[model samples]
Target: DFSEGLARVKVGNKWGFIKEEGGVVIPPQFDEVYDFSEGLAVVKIGNKYRYIDKEGGFVFNIEFEWAQSFSGGQARVKFGDKYFEINKEGKIITQGREDLFPVKIGDKYGYIDISFNIRIEPQFDEACDFREDLAAVKIKDKWGYINKEGEIKIKPRFAGCLSFSEGLAAVSEFDKKWGYINKDGKYEIQPKFDMAMDFSGDRAEVKIGLTRYYINRNGEIIKEIIDIEHEEI
Candidate 1:
């Protein structure tokens, strides 16, 4: 898939990058490569992973056992069963968000402030990070939305759900079919897709049976994805 104006392509058994105009930008060499993020991409050579620039130049001399694409100016990497967030200069980030952090006491989960004070008492069966002022929490076996003050904004009814992106969140009901919902606990897009992803920009990716495509906020299919290698030459 194309990301940040470049797409990784496979030639024979090696992976490389190409421009949108179908011109080879980075020759096929790496064993595996991830989509670029924040002007850098993770490339795997042999069993080690490293970051590389658009010109195929190595950004970091140190290699990691596993690495992920950069997001919000940082990327997570694993060395020996431990994951660490690193910056573009390969420096480990120790500080996290100052707002609220998920904390687990016994078997229940809750949120705590940066000063280690319990902001929300641990009561949820499961809790996730807050996004757009709302967090997804599990009560017994159902999922619901909760505000930062621990108020139940949306009742626990969904079988599964994701944090809100843009202005909506993807959720599943008893039928296990995924759909979208607004902040008021109203369905914006009816449940029908076999799987649904959070909206990125103005489009969200969805799957129905064996077909996967992009859908707009209005539940309209905007583009159909076709594998590059599968296209007729």
Candidate 2:
């Protein structure tokens, strides 16, 4: 059992969910099952797909040929030759793959919502996928952050920037020194390293001069590496 409080287990030729105590929560009745997300999971019966609640109840009667897990309150579904986006209530929101995909218009990039409505206008020179509810976008040569609603949460200031990870993102400003910034665009670790990587397990690997080391969230050097070569930045 994981965070969803249930784990998939194989029983004979079928699959079911087991609780933390190894008790069956959902009986092995479906041909296939997917992990739960947003309190629902996708289950397959024969060649049809539908969502089921944590209690193993069907969320809606409409079944599709294929489906994807919910993300940002929407899931992609395929019926016949057309693809659609639907909400948790199984209501169709859109008719194509736009919110889950980046759209390119002319020389700019932007994104849409589950309704096929333009959430972000095509104004960025480049854009990256959303991570941790925010996406990194480039305007000319600087990078910034935007919320899912397409609002500029962080202004374009960094010469280079990466997507958010563990509440912080690595950024640089022309000097080739990298640092970590919070969601509010404030520098948690002052830009001083030659290179930096995303924070993992409360620490990040950074390079200064030719030495590499790991720094904690407080920007304290916790460990040092002496064998890593000074790679080109």
Candidate 3:
């Protein structure tokens, strides 16, 4: 990600990579270009997949049906109907495409890393992407969480869910209400509200009864969006 400075963006569009300060360095010549991540980005040219360095140099030959932005040294790509990850050399980084999705081998869902590696086993009723080294996994029709090692960090309880952010995750109870959960799956903000969302910039939008408000990370009321005592119009 261009966290600082500007240049001709590493990728291309009509104007290619736009630097942070708004300088065109690489000169976007790519039919499609993505933001730089880990010093590299995915680029496309004439129906080919490849990677490009910050200087706009092609790092590898385009050899995939489709490609996406690189993340953690790899990117999710497709080849002839199957998706996989490829290194900068345009080589399949894994044994095959088995790890590119949450495959339900028999009757469960889980995650797989780029190497066809079972980062999380297929043992959950459902699963979501990993965030903060953790992911939401369902068990017995209830929601929970698991670590990268496939260990259950938080037991299934929520009725609905979302990925973690700013240290909390949205959760819902089967009989109670929806709220946010800490890393331990315990309701940091109890399941008392009618609905809630994860924390964003130290504050989260929350709903109680029929009112919506913003709350700090500590679950303390920060501002009420509709105080009802205020005038509208």
What lDDT does the true structure give each of the candidates? 0.87, 0.82, 0.70
Candidate 2's C-alpha runs over 4 A off are: 1-100, 113-117, 226-233
Model 1 lDDT per residue over 83-139, tens place: 667777886664753366566666788886533357899899988878888999999
Tens-place lDDT digits, model 2, residues 28-60: 988898888888888889988988888899987
lDDT of 3 at 52: 75
Supply the global lDDT for candidate 2. 0.82
lDDT tens digits, residue span 1-233, model 3: 55324343443235377666656777767776666667777667777766778777777644556778777666778743457666655556745322334545457776655543455667777777677777787888788887777888988777888889988998887887877887977777776677788777899888888889898877788899865576786
By the lDDT metric, which is better: model 1 or model 2? 1
Residue 146's lDDT within candidate 3 is: 79
Candidate 3, residue 143: how far the Cα is off, in Å: 0.5
Q: Is candidate 1 or candidate 3 better by lDDT?
A: 1
- Best model per lDDT: 1
- Which candidate leads in TM-score? 1
Residue 22 CA error for candidate 3 (Å)? 50
Q: List ranges where model 1 is wrong by over 4 Å.
A: 1-98, 230-233
